[model samples]
Target: MTLQQAPETVRVTAAVEERMVTPSLSVQGVVSGAPTREVRFEGSAGGAKQIVTSVAVAQDASIAFGDLLATVSGVPVFLLPEGVPLYRDLRHGDSGPDVSAFQSLLTRLGYLRGSATGTVDARTLTATGLWYKAYGQKLPESEGKPYVAVDHFAAATGEGTVRLGPTVGQRLEPGKPLFVLSAGQQAVTARFTVPEADAVKVGTAVTVRASGGASFAGTIASIGPFQSNEASKEQRAGHDVRVELSLQDAAAPKEASTVSVTVGGQGRRGPAVPLSAIRQGSQGTYVTRELEGENSSGTPPTRDVTVAVLAQEGGWASIETNPELPPGAKVIVG
Candidate 1:
């Protein structure tokens, strides 16, 4: 009774404030086509009827540039680069960006000489003649060369899978779709409810987590407006939206493949502390700041400060608090 209680002692572990933070939202998504193209055999049978006498590659075969896709009436139909899918034939006086591209590619392939003037002039025909000769075919007497046929041997700008639509004995029709070629390029798509849609926007940076722990970086390319799906009862009851993402990385997730997507908001730079320092209270979330004793000599007292948690990631959070936290400020984490 005579002895007074020693000065109250408070012992606790804590973390210090370091820097700012950005928050993230994780969602489920599927790998889908940025756009799957149907590769059609646009070659004319030269006004003579021809049947698909024989088949070459099997269904779903992975084809590459210069690979022989099939044999059409004893003539080799090969997979070439993407540029050959021209809608109309390329001829002199037909000047456009497409012609320029064709000219450039022909020059690079050593099939043509002179600059790519963007106009299909005499040089284009010279290049065309050389290409036809190399491919064992003579230049057509027709005014325009079959640009689509040239695609048969032009370098494949995009690699794709073989989707054969025509079979042996099938009659070829002028301008009708033949076999389809899939480029196999893909993007990621995420679904969300009306409420969640408000938080997401195009141009938001995102990371897709693939199977086996692989992660790829991308950006939100589009956000679809809310629409009802009459096919599903649940979907019909709530507004649903789609978010399309464009991958910055080369490797694309397989078709119909599922992956995890982490969407992050525009990053902000500021002071941050360990997540443990944040506490949920009756009022809201808050953190305890340690105050220095007289002359900064002894154990310090602590005061609770209200804070608005903006974002939390990587074990830290970006917060809005009064009298912004100073570097090295001690905070009670536990």
Candidate 2:
């Protein structure tokens, strides 16, 4: 005549709809760019001290072929394309790689026609004169013919844009850099642990968050070889590898800026439930799913459904089961 015991009730939560589950890793990095070359004052100031009379370009300004960079000692300094340094003066009869490079610059500036012949011929001389005249300066002459002098222009070793170095009224010396010329596209570089290096590959998608709260998409451009740090009294020994990222449809900050990079792995979409809802027993991993209607005893019927865990991230487990667990299905989590 003992009273019948009531079944213990369990709390339940709904299984989320199928969605993409992706593992992510965040790292700190800095915006960077390709190698930079120094723009120097290759011209001479007679025997007088070379002084920057005026500066036409601002710092971090983008310069192009035949653009006036500055004026030194009343002489204009023009920006030339990357090539062999303008060493000796070039006259109409000069013939060599330097002359060829100069001719190429003239052609790019629309001052010369056709291809560069690698010789300072009549076309080259006339182009040089027009180039100087365009910038409001008279072309230097040698033997009664216009010629290119070393000091009238500064040649960069690479191209793209430039970061100006010198300022107005600053004394300049021959061979000293007037600016730093950027050679290629800007990028971001980050150091990653050995495990991270192994997990990621080139072309992996990533999101970059700048220090100013701007976020943009990027991709893994390159990965450098691993490097081990030497043990020092001031630092612990460790190993890391460098990873470079290229921005998409955006430009990095002009100066090197700190950024947060979130690298995401491949994603898998499937039915997902709370990690706590997954139960493991001798029968294998399963979840206690509540059935549709209550039984005659007035209690909700439940069944343990076996599941194959596909992926688990952020306290959520993506699973596969024989009978599809549709979205909003109630599952016992507590």
Best by TM-score: 2
Model 1 Cα displacement at 249 (Å)? 14
Candidate 1 yields a Cα-based lDDT of 0.62
Worst 10 residues of 2 by lDDT: 234-243
Task: Name the Cα RMSD for model 1.
Answer: 11.9
lDDT of 1 by residue, 114-228 (tens): 7878777876787776766665655554545433244233234565665545688888776665556566435676765432344456676778888868787776776775565
> Lowest lDDT 10-mer window, candidate 1?
234-243
Clashing pairs in 1: 19-271, 19-272, 20-270, 39-181, 80-156, 81-154, 81-155, 81-156, 81-157, 82-157
**TM-score (all chains, Cα) for each model:** 0.41, 0.58
